[model samples]
Target: MKTRQALFLVWAACTALANHGAWAQNNPVLLADVKAPRVLMVEEATGTVLLSRKPDEPFAPGSIAKMMTVETVLDALSRSEISLDTTYPVTEFAWRTGGAPSRTTTMFAALRSNITVRDLLSGVIVQNANDGCIVLAEGLAGSEPAFVTRMNERANTLGLSGSRFGNSTGLPPAESSMTAIDMVRLARHMRTAYPQVLPLYTQADFEWNRIRQRNKNPLLGTIAGVDGFAAGFAEGAGFSLMATAMRGDTRLYLAMSGLASEKERQDEAARLLEWGFNGFTSLTVYGAGNVVGQAVVYGGAAEKVALAPREDVRVYAPTGDLGRLSAQVVYRGPIRAPINRDQEVGRIRIMIGDAVLQEAPVYTSEAVGEGGLASRAKDAVWSLLFSWL
Candidate 1:
């Protein structure tokens, strides 16, 4: 494998935007004021992270893990393994552990009573019902432990490397943890993959067994564009929140943990959400279909193949010019011949200083077939020379 540094230029227009008086200066000071030990805020459109601190450090997710639980169920629904109308019984275990007996957040469903998947989702989303999570876990996988296995598997499939589920309900005494970055990834995936089901998070309240509870997420309705996601707390991890907000064409996902109080959690989340929306502007790094870079094609008719992003490669940059911006096209090479058009070959990583702010996949723009014996021989000689160097 070899690494090549390709040319990456920032358009003058981006610099002009940064200079414009309308935009606020990049505020590292404000970000520093955030009290959470782990925090991340990302632009949904370009996946550009506006602010991050200890994003990869794992912490007890508390009720925030419910988002993953919801994602697992949504995955099952998409696979047709279960329907919204499917029902599960609330066993004594569920009632004792998460319902009225446990004195935690719950939908208060009667023991041995069966509830529909639709209602369970409502309970989980709107009420953060632990019993609903247990019932759904048991119903879907015949036991909570079995369902937990599915949850961890789903997390892996989703590329959430910093998360693990010990139980469906995220209750204490059951080990479950997640990173700030993983929470953002999960929230983004849920919103993107399950748009139809996202409205469940906006539901203000849910009623079951004649007991009603308002949505536990504090940001909803209070923040200008806050809509869905969850808030959580653990004894050692303190408070945590995973939330998404949309204002017009832009949407942002945020995750923060290790706050001192619930008030701090809500306040820090709101502050970051506002900052994410107002503190950055979009900059197109590469237009749609524009060749971003090139990758060596081994034994191909052509020595190299052009690579481009299928969509416009964009990043949300700070309004102020506080840091140097650069990009690199990264790929393992030389890619073998017979590469098809639009085949993914590499990634474009956009960075500020040494920190990667965003990354997007790049693909071959055209097919490259195997070359003649002479071409192969020439490439082999060049490869040998480079190896010696």
Candidate 2:
């Protein structure tokens, strides 16, 4: 009979120090010179976004969609549905469209030749081989269209909501697209989920059918700690990149699009990544199992239930700017009882000024059962009294 109260609890205890270790007395780096129209940088360890600009705007993924193709194949390999040694034939259509005849990036796979998945993956990752992508797609799913269906399904499964695939090659006329943040998420997932496959991205070149081509990613060796990923360009999308770099204990993931030129893409990506590495410090706001707040429970034995994060709640704060940091625990209450222990009930948002830096899910620390009729009636009256507030 009572209306549920939506709770918004400000977590005053969430305070961070302005100066951290080596970053003392330093101001956060500004990204004014970076020319990309869409960009995002994330701290991989804390899952904190360090910087962003129009991260959700969709753009053609270009050859970067090959990352998803790689992910799909890795998923199949994990399920034992295929293996690196599995061979796929280079069909006439594949050779004509993406191979020697197409004059696009290719491994120059001979038509009707059987190539192992391992070599095809190398060709795709190291050389951005369009023909290799087609052969693998056709071999695995009987056709590229069927394979694209799987790519979209996998994107949904991975929470890449802003991504869609019409082809495995990411070439034009395929209708594939992704947002900057989505590409960063996909890059993060690939690194975490497929560690064994990462070396292929870093491989300098792949030699197939007596022809060798080097990896096209510009950031690979030019930046210290830069490891793997891809870069691409479309007619209207300009240039784009999905990159990851590591410096000792910290790692950063980046995605950017709509740059003016290849040189601009490389320079902007390097500058942004360097800024991410130097500008932020990790701030632990709440330790694991520390009760962050309480939410009112209706018709429960207990009046309120404690909430906490499953893991340590950490955020990346800009150097020398802790004054902008704040946090809040948000939940819809009075939560109806019989609540299960460890059930996810809400989220804690870490903010920097008006922008949300990161969010972590909060859960009920303990179970609460339905209360007796007398307690329910009391709760009903209490809810009614406060409902107007």
Please state every model's RMSD to the true fold in angstroms.
4.6, 3.2
Steric overlap count per candidate: 0, 1
lDDT for model 2: 0.87
- The CA lDDT at 336 in model 2 is 90
Which model scores highest in TM-score?
Answer: 2
* Candidate 2 lDDT by residue in tens digits, 88-117: 999999999899999999999999999999
- Per-residue alpha-carbon lDDT of candidate 1 for residues 1-389, written as tens digits (9 for 90 to 100): 34232333322222323344554576543666878899988888887877789999999999999888899999999999999999999999999998999999999989999999999999999999999999999999999999999999999999999999999888899999999999998988888899999888888887888888788889989998889899999989999998899998899888899999998888888778877877777777667788867888888999889988888778887766434566678887788788999999888877767777778888999999999999988877777766653
Clash count, predicted structure 1: 0
Model 1, residue 282: what's the lDDT?
Answer: 78
Error of 2 at 233 (Å): 0.8
lDDT, model 1: 0.85
Q: Name the weakest run of 10 consecutive residues (lDDT summed) in model 2.
A: 15-24
Winning model by lDDT: 2
